[model samples]
Target: MSFLIKNKLGLARTGIIKTAHGNVETPNFAFVATHGFIKSLKEEDYFSLAPELTISNTFHLFVTGKHKEIKKAGGLHKMFPLKNPIMTDSGGFQVFSLGWGKKHNIGKVDKTAKNPACVQPVDKSTRPPARDVSKTTCVAGGVRACLPTGRLEKDRNPVKILSDRVIFTYDGKKFELTPRKSIKIQEDLGADIIFAFDECTSPLHDYEYNKKSLKKTHSWAKECLKAKKKNGQMLYGIVQGGIFENLRKESSSFIGALPFDGFGIGGSFGEKQMEEVIGWALSGLPENKPRHLLGIGAIKDIFIGVGKGIDTFDCVIPTREARHGAVYSMEGRLDIKRGVFEKDKKALDKGCGCFVCSSGIKRKDLRILFKENIPEAQRLATIHNIHFYKKLFGKIREAIDSGKRSNLKKLEKHYKF
Candidate 1:
């Protein structure tokens, strides 16, 4: 399996990723379906919204049943019952093993702006914190973020899963994740594209720690390949070197030379550092192989990523954000439960040209429908966000094919890439 870069705009590119499952088009987006399902969107809905290949989680599945069980059940392809190609993470990235950081919670700064119910609770420190009782926000037309406040934190406790095999602690629990276990799990799941077990470090870590972690990851990746070899399955080597450019260059250069099918840009760079790191990593990477940016799938980020030569990205942003009643559109994003759309008849994106937009579902109708149930609400939001993702990639790829990919930055203001 290999990725062929057919066109280039600066460092950005349009390409094709040939996988055993099938093929994933370049500059594409894959919605995360951890465990067996995507939260609110049905498999049919997903195909309808984007019709692109998708990826699933490996760690979560392992926790429930052994990988051998899945292989007996006819592998992930039969278990998930999908026609498009599928990809799986190596289960080593602490994020998947951990969840959002419940066991040993760290570095989640709270950003609050005028207590909007549409926005989640803001914690000045710690992970996702409690909601501000003083704020009021809406989701859909009239669906207010009207939580009673006393039980929000208890309801949505997030954490990261690790690969150390022992359940590590966070807030107050242990999250034990091991590499061998992850490899076994993904192998049974049998995804077309698999990632190596790499530690996702924080940007605040010192140079020595970063260097040590990267080296460990390299060794672990090699071991992962040895332990979980599968015919037609492709493995990806992650490039991790934190915010230091020299380290990033070295890491990318070294990882690029390895006998891996593709590459993934893992953590160590948060939102602020995302673009710069992509630029540095791609500097020494060969254009022949596919490059993926892990956990980034927003519209603006999509443009920036494509412009910087990322072929694929996977994130729960669309479905997760939509679960909170937020929706993305061509014009921009607005919380569906906000006060502004209470009676608005306009679709989430008037020009979106998707089924949901054409469904003529009123905001008030959606709000009332969701009050009846969260799944119904999540479905509508998922529809809109999926459309947004599909459109972003489609436009970028079109630009690349048309020899105008360089102008993609004009779609947004910040031109970091």
Candidate 2:
């Protein structure tokens, strides 16, 4: 695998990632195809959208025992109709997702909002006995009493984090995933690009926690490299450091020095700190190899990432939001389920070339379909949003290739960013 830079505008550039399956353009978006396919879309629908790249979840396939069938069928391409470049993430994010994310009810981006799942710490005198605690709700003088803060501590997390591996408890069963096992699974699944297994820390984790996690992540990266036996797949090491600038730069320098084909900037941070965090993460990375921003795909964030020299991104925002009746357009997102659109006759987006728009599926029509609980509602919305992102990235590449900053500025205005 090779990354060829065709054009450069500041840190942003237009490039081609040469993969075994095909070439993927730089500053592009990889639509999430979790569970082997994009949810609610059929083969025909996927073919119609014709995404340039798509990513699948390694943990989901491993847990569901689908990797065996895919390996038997000669990889994801043979098992599915998708022929474009595919990327499979290591199950690292599950460390945060299944553990702290579930326990704290938080997401990758910390909004600085208080966790609703958390309660005030209880006074020792007001606390109920250990045996009665299970039978009665935390109450004091007819008011809801605070609970013990220790209940939400690290040990209470459903997923156990270890130095070399992680143990996930799901659906009443425990599954262990090690660095070597993660790489083996990705190799068996046969993707053009695979990620090194690293512990993705949360934005809410304090400095001391992230520092310890970073050491484990760095060790896993080396183990993943040693575990790779396939010469065809390109492995990208991940940089993890939570939200600390020093840790981000340290991880970046360490992972950047590795022999991996490319690099992925993983872990979570506050929304406001994205640009700063990305700068710290990319400071020590080499200029030649491709850099991917994992799990980030907001329109403004894509522009920010590309400007920071990120080559690719993968996120569930487009398809996931589409399934919930949100439609992406030049004007902004539209909620098709809203009553305001019930009598509107405009297309999903004016002058859009997507199948749904070209077919004259008016907002009112989609609104009625969603109201009627028809399955096509989600499919139509998904197709449109996917095309919107495809077109957005195309325009971005064009703007970069043209060597014109004005073109990029025009896109920001056009997208209402």
Compare the candidates by TM-score and give the number of the best one.
2
Best by lDDT: 2
- lDDT tens per residue, model 2, 159-246: 8887777998877788999999999999999999999999887654667777898999999999999999998899999998877889
What RMSD, rounded to one decimal, does every model reach?
8.0, 5.7
Residue range with the least summed lDDT across 10 consecutive positions in model 1: 108-117
Task: Please provide TM-scores, in order, for all candidate models, with all chains considered together.
Answer: 0.80, 0.91
> What is the C-alpha lDDT profile of model 1 across 1-417, one tens digit per residue?
767778877777788888776777788887777865577777687557644766787766665554567789877777765656677886655452253322223221112221222222222222333454433433422222223456545554444322333343445544455666666677778777888877765432446656776776766767776776567777888888766678789888888878778889876454455678788877777778888888777666777687777889988888788888877765566677766777878777767776777888766666666666757788787777777777777877887777764356555552222
Q: Provide the clash count, candidate 2.
A: 0
Error of 2 at 303 (Å): 0.9
Compared to the true structure, candidate 2 yields what TM-score?
A: 0.91
Clashes of 1: 35
